[model samples]
Target: MARWKAYFSFKLWLYSFRLKKFLGYWLAVFSVIWTFTEFSGYFFTAVDGSPWKPNVWGVIGLGIVAAIWMSRPLLRRTVLLPDQEVMLEIDINDMYARQDGAWIIPCNRCFLHSHIDEQAIVVQFRNRFFPSPADFDQVLAQVLQNVPYELDTVRGTQVKKYPIGTVVPVQLHGTRQTAYLLATSELTSQGKGDPNLNHLEDSLKSLWSYIAENGNTEPIIIPILGSGRHRLVVSRYVIIGMIVKSFLAGLAQRKFTKRLTIVMQPKAFIHNQYNLDEIESYFSCAGKFEFDSKGL
Candidate 1:
């Protein structure tokens, strides 16, 4: 009778373990699927109802699944230091302070300039308050002429440039017609400082041109222009969102591929105050890249 009882107890333990493993696998698969679906539904839905409202149960289930999925990987992968390769360089103070590599300097005068050897370039500012599209075009033409690279624009789509170390600008012209201008200004002010919206726009146009011409192969490098000396108040997420939106717009139009690499200088509060883990989390969540000055 005792031997029979032991056999039953062992069978129960084995069954429980197998059940736990099975539950874990499904949880991870569902969480990823739900997250992706939620994002798509939110973007494509035209109605006013909350997308998350319908997925509340799925979200909860995903959370449970994610918890289990994360645990197993914790032991296998060691979080390495943020070491994104340097594809291009921007002439920010900190970036220069850290490395003496080929640098891109914004001419503040020439709408656009590219120094291929140093893998550096600059986008000149056109205005303080707001510049018109004509001004942006003029600046871009100058950039094209001076910057030793090809320009490619298609059917009002974003541009593309080649050679991994390219300097692209994110221009912000206070043109009301331009979607997300106001939002971009608010974001710029929050992130760096007041940036010349026109310069931002011109830069973005130039960026699209570069993408269109060269195709998105090598990662491009850029600094938070208005956010720095320009004093554009904006969050990192907002800036990233704008950039991504532009990239996607180009992609949708079949202008270029979607490969992109964005770089930014750490704020004083962050560099001076936060530890490595907090900073790592911030950039990692924003996008994949190394935080070192080597790849300014």
Candidate 2:
């Protein structure tokens, strides 16, 4: 029953004009193939010497071809940028369980590891990567030793707050892979995260710079920053656009990672109405943007 529902959902998406331009190109290709095959029977006559006419079987075969072509956009959730080795994906899965590459976990400026809730991504990172909370803090401390703090305050749980774009690469246990703890959100007086668009872009820039120096061309998995608890006053789609734009700008300067996956949980994908086809379109057109040293 669930499979049937999913099939219908895909069917709705298939012809919904979300991928209309791609669908149009594929349909044109199939039409040319059919036309060429039909005319080929005239010149390269078979033993039977019968001209092939459009029949039910041919129509069914064409339908199958069309279905396969349309399904390509919906089925394959990843896209490679034009003339670039870097691959971009919009994966609908848990970021931790999906890959072994460096994961970017958006964190508050304070770099607090003990105060996050059970549902936060930071807590999930601790549970998945570390054997215990102490181990997580140990790795975090080792990475943040060189990172400078912007201000010192006696208020809230943390006294020192790191600047925006501060990235702490946490070396996972028993593996050489690293997970970047990116400080994208500012810690407010009430202990809530205060993330803005400018800060998000800065954090991403810092993330790519750190990865370029430290990463080994491994795939990097990142969630849509500011889409979670920070709740930046922007659409999830816009946040995704920002992430891709920043990453591509970074890529222009140097090749850091071979692949970059922008992970969205299944719930977020459904609730936010994210279309991978649309994301792919956005990424393909990203070539026009110039990479400036200031920001994307």
lDDT of 1 by residue, 1-296 (tens): 32233223433234222446646766776667777777777677546664543366766677666655443311001122233221212111233332222122343332222211222222232233225546655645543554563344323433433322234333344432111111122212112223555545555555555556744333333344444444446654454445544444444344443234334443432332212233334434433522221211
- Residue 166 lDDT in candidate 1: 36
Which candidate ranks first by lDDT, i.e. highest? 2
Task: Give the C-alpha miss distance for residue 267 in model 2, angstroms.
Answer: 0.5
Each prediction's total of clashing residue pairs, residues at least 3 apart in sequence or on different chains, is 49, 0
For each candidate in turn, the TM-score is 0.32, 0.75
Provide the overall lDDT of each model, using Cα atoms, as 2-decimal numbers.
Answer: 0.38, 0.74
Worst 10 residues of 1 by lDDT: 176-185
> Which regions of candidate 2 fall more than 4 Å away from where they truly are?
1-76, 150-155
Instruction: Report model 1's TM-score to 2 decimal places.
Output: 0.32
Residues 1-296, candidate 2: write the lDDT tens digits.
32233334543365334455656755676677677777876677556776755564675577557755665435236777667677887776677866557888998888775766887899998887678999887777777788777665424443678888888877766787678889998877777777688899888888898888877788899988889888798988898888888888888888988888888766665555556667777767766667575646
